[model samples]
Target chain A: MTLALRVEHLRKSYGAVAALDDVSFEVERGEVFALLGPNGAGKTTSIEILEGFIARDAGSVEVLGIDPGDRQHLRGLRDRIGVVLQELAVESFFTVRQVLERNAGFYPHPRDVEEVIDMVGLSEKSDAKVKRLSGGQQRRLDIGLGIVGNPELLFLDEPTTGLDPAARRTTWDLIRHLAAEGTTVLMSSHYMNEIEALAQRVAVLSHGRVAALGATATLGGRDRSEATIRFTLPSGVAASDLPITPWRVEGDTVEVRSDDELRALHALTSWALEGHIAVTGLSVARETLEDIYLALTRGDRAEIDEEPDDTKARTP
Target chain B: MSTDVRPAPQRSRFSDLRLVAHQVKYEQLAFWLNRVGAVFTVGFSVVFLVMLGASAGSQKVQSLGDISLVSYYVPGFIAYGVMAAGFTTLSVTLVVRRETGLLKRLRLSPVPTWVLISSILISTAIITLVQALLLVVIGRYGYHVAFPSSWLALLVAVIVGILGFAAMGVAISAVVPNQESAGPVTSIVFFVLLFLAGLWFPLPPNSGLAKFSNYLPVRHLIIAMDHAFGVPRGATPWAWHDLLVVALWGAGATLVSLRRFRWAPRRV
Candidate 1:
């Protein structure tokens, strides 16, 4: 309902490389917003600047209604914000409960340490040394640390990057639960499904610039984009006999792309009915979020942009 | 500037002090729970004292007066304990913490830098104090060596050494590039300093090793501990001049730490 954080013309440079160039976005008090970008796309840099961990070169940045750039106000702002970095920062020797309790002491109003343990699904491992926990469990404990303070705003930079499928699903549920409980969540991820599953709105960053910003489904007008309809041609049928000509045909398959998918589908099915032909392998699908993301970023490594299995690093 | 007066996490001074105590409790837990870290930080001094005491027996060091070799060994190992805890162990731990992103996490938390720093320093002081006490007990009971004549003087020297070495610890941690090299870098620097400071054997007052190490804090801390223990027999149990030199090195190291300290991981 209210602005939790706002940035205006945010700019930062690392020597010759501009890490963030005129970045601007606003996060509402209870919205789950996402910054979708690759490795060097300035997502982490933006999060760090907002967390008061680093200063912006030139920008009017405000977090929780306080200027993060002002040194005197940073502590109070930190009290209201939670950060989960890419690295699991829990010490190897301290037990889960011990680390949580220690960090809890830093905040004026800390959540119940036991409740945080349960919330992160680490109740059974509270007394276990951090080094003993599995990677997923450790990642859960790391999230537990972030929320132990009951912060108003949560910053999660690649929260589930190295997590397995089950762990990632649990993490997504936990993030949703937090956001539903009125915690403004700002997150960055390389996974499109993750953004689609969680974020209500997203800002796609590329080369340190906001290439696209809108609701997740409608990003880059993807919802309004033309849908592709594909159907394998019936044996001995001519492509020209159809009411609408195919956009492209490869071998026996016919591809049809149109903004009026309903009209096109009707025409193709009507022709099939008249010819007593079965329209097998027929499907109509909108532009996938990954496809739109790549298009918006100007094809910033399609391999890195979409596939999590490959394209390891993304250049700035 | 008016809006700068923000809501503090813990408003009262008493509560802020409690916050540091809270962090220190976990720090101690972290150190002691790790068997290897505890052994390396505190056990080393205990093991060294017992071994050296058994071998030195009744041998006398006639450098200034006939102080038995075991008595000299006690103060020397005690100083070594302080440096090991505050300098070597602290530096390596810090580098690992920084490289692992622990420091960045702490920086992002609501806790002030002062609280985080003081908690670690206090934790280091506690480790050193425990070692010093353990060594003193071993010397007094196991080897029949007399305790420091002035316990207050020894406490002052121990505190000074802790502060000085802790500063140098932060300074050295800043130079260490990564976690893999943290141990080797700190140990190599520490062992060389220890050798020059005469930990293996007491340096004769004006020996070349003594003259050279005089400019380093390790030797000054050793001399201060020696005076507190009255190693040369009936000497003043205060070494203000030596403590001053150690304090100066600490101040210089403090400047280096201020200039070079970074919270974020270097590789990132």
Candidate 2:
């Protein structure tokens, strides 16, 4: 597959702090690539570099096979690359439809304003002033403006950050539809679950570098051979004389780790049968993307002393 | 994916042109709908015209053979209208956008930055032109202010003045950290210019301050505009010098602003 975007050794700094350091990633064409990071993790910086909004300190970056800062090429690529900024403060004076229509003029083959409006579920609020729309509705309008140009590549930066759960789901569906229509999407979100649902692949960033990256199901070695089984033991069991099986117990519940689920289940059932013990509240679940995300972020945060003031400084 | 030719999107300067025109059109519509803004422009013109009418008598102070105090103030009023359009409209809108985060949102659009800035300039210019026409009509009917002899120079000065002040406003908006500061900063700068440049009242002709006012842009613009009303071009400096200054200021402002502008909120 042709790479839609490629970055090598991208670096940026704000004063003494490194915002992005030695970061590299490739997004395949027509694929949904998610950049997952906490606040101040340089996702915005990376995306801005690709969008040619800010200059990179040192790096070779290419979007659509063109250097982003080359004005002519950048302008040429603009119509094909749509950027949905996190903030949706469009000029409130103009109606939603008017704003979309004005932006549509920049593209050679823009989608119809009406169609984009309907796609974002803002058809009913099309004529309303942008300032008057509810937060979710304004976000929908922002998406409408971004896609009105029928862009081939879309950059969505925390697009659903402040949205309620229902609104966020609606936006997710809209994004899925866009991807299904062959538009490449690069999304950034703090919500790990959202990324698992939306991104085919995710790159986890920490301290100016990629901490982990892979397909969502297998990210951070999640798909490796391991299963965690939890079961409640019957009364008078697990006093350290249970069996030769690999297991640990805390009170009545026992957690067993095994590479073979059938073997573990067989051993546990046989032990219960032999002992006339009942296994209660037995359940099995796989490691989720959230688990990997937490482990990575926790480990990464432990490596750096992030003063709380630094977080406050990043927010307005 | 081979041989997938959908007739690649056309590359055209006209694309930016059309986009700019559309932006200006919508901005103009919004400005017209702003009742407070409309009152400042149109209502201010009416008030200025009525004052000139009431004082059109022996209260006249003649700068040229045929021109009266009414005609002199007519040019000043028109210049004031232009200033308000350029500085107040553009600055207030920018600060509000900054406060509301609208300006940052526009930066993310595919539209070129120049297109966005120029669209605002063009929209404000068009609105000011309408106000100027209203002033002209009121001047002719109510105060009997004649059409100036130097119409071309007056037009050039107004256009250059608009560009210069709009650029300055953009620069001002950039340094202003927020909306509240935006108001006081713009108001102080604007009122100082109006006071020193004699937009409310012309400085004494041939006086040192009046000559010094020649260096101020609005002063020359007003003089040039009055010249459009048949007022002679005094041996003093011509309007073109002020226009050159305005052009330089515009370029300087654009450079400073583009460099200093930030897309995200500042760290407090």
Candidate 3:
């Protein structure tokens, strides 16, 4: 597959602190790629470098086969890329339709304004002024502006930071629909569930470095983590009665860590049946993306301290 | 999936012009919808015209060929109106837009940075023209101020004043640190310059203060407007010196603004 974006050894320092430290990744065309990290993980810095908003200190970066550092190429590159900034960026006095039409004029081959409005689910509020729209509606308008240009690539920086659950789900559907239509999307978000629901691949950044990068299901060996099995035992059943070799008991509940969840579940169910004891609330779970993310980022505090003071000053 | 999509065409200067036209149209629409700010922008000029005309309409000033005080103040207030729209209003709006991330958002669009800046300047020019026309109408009917003696010179002076002041506004916005400070900084700069321009009252010819005022852009703007309206300052029917001074200030301010302009918020 063709790559939509590629960054090799991207390095950016704000004074002495390295905001993006030798980061490298490639996003395939028509794929949904997520940059997952905490608040100071340099997500914004990395994305901005790719977007041509900020220059990188040292790196080889390409978007749509154009170097972002090439000022002359920026106008052409911008025509093919759509960006939904992290902030609510719209003229408050303009109506929704006006805002869409204005932004649509910036590109050579813009999507129909009405179609973009409908795609973002802002049709009903099309005539309402931007200031009058609810926070969620305004956010939809922001998305509407981003897609109005019919861009081949879209960059969404924390697309659903403050959105309610329902609104966030709608945005997720919108992103999925776009990717399905062959629009490559690069999204940065701290919400792990959002990454799980939409991203085909994810790169977790910690302390300005890619701590882990892979397909969402397999990131940081998540698929290989031990499964956790928990069940509540029937009254008068003691933990010692369980056939499992290693188990912990709390109240009437028993927990067991199992490498093979299917076999462990089968053995426990059979034991319960033989002992005439019921296993209530039985569940088998494994480490989630959030768990893996925490594990990857948890040990980077010392690296932060090792940086020179001038580099540290640029962290924020 | 088909990968036959063509690359975006190289942008021509004509496209940049078209973008500016489009942006100016929407900016005008936005300004119109902001009724309160719009009212204040234009209303301040009207209020000053009425107050000054009512109080000193009949008083004759010798430098203006014995024209009524209302006539003298007409050109002065016109200069004031252009400055308000171009310098004060533009600065405040630009600062607010920058603070709200509107400029940064625009930067992400295919619109060139120059196009964005030019569109705003053009919008302010349009508004200043409207204010000038309205002030003339109010002066003609309400206070009997004469029509401009030379329409062409009046047009040139107004254009020069608008462009110059608009550039100055953009420069001022760069110095302004944040939105909260935008108002106070612009207002203080505006009123101080207005005073130096002799809007409330004309300074005596060849006096120390008036000689100093001759070097200021606002004073030159007001004097040029007076000469264009057939109110000769002395021997000449036009104020070439004043026009040159105003143009130089405009050019200087524009240079400063272009050098210092920032699309994104400044980092501490």
Model 1 chain A lDDT-worst window of ten: A307-316
- For residues A1-316, write the lDDT of model 3, one tens digit per residue: 6889999999988666777899999999888999998776788788888888877889799998999888889888999999998888888888899999989988999999999999999888899989998888888889888899898899999999999999898999999999999999999998999999999999999989999999999997879989989888667766776778556778766789988889988898898888778679988889999999999888655333332212100101
Here, model 1's chain A TM-score works out at: 0.91
Most DockQ-accurate candidate = 1
Per-model i-RMS:
9.7, 7.3, 7.4
* Alpha-carbon runs more than 4 Å astray in model 3: A230-255, A265-283, A299-316, B7-11, B62-65, B204-216, B232-237, B266-268
Over 4 Å off, model 1: A231-243, A249-254, A269-281, A299-316, B1-10
RMSD of 2: 5.1
- The candidates' DockQ values read 0.37, 0.26, 0.34
Per-residue lDDT of A15 in model 1:
69
lDDT of 1 by residue, A47-159 (tens): 98898777789989988899987888888788888989989888988888988888888889899999999999998888998899999999989999899988888999999
Which of 2 and 3 is the better model by DockQ?
Answer: 3
Clashing pairs in 3: A16-A310, A16-A311, A17-A311
Interface RMSD of 2: 7.3
Give per-model CA RMSD.
5.1, 5.1, 4.3
Cα deviation of A44, candidate 2, in Å: 0.9
Please give the CA lDDT of all the candidate structures. 0.86, 0.75, 0.83
Worst 10 residues of 2 chain A by lDDT: A307-316
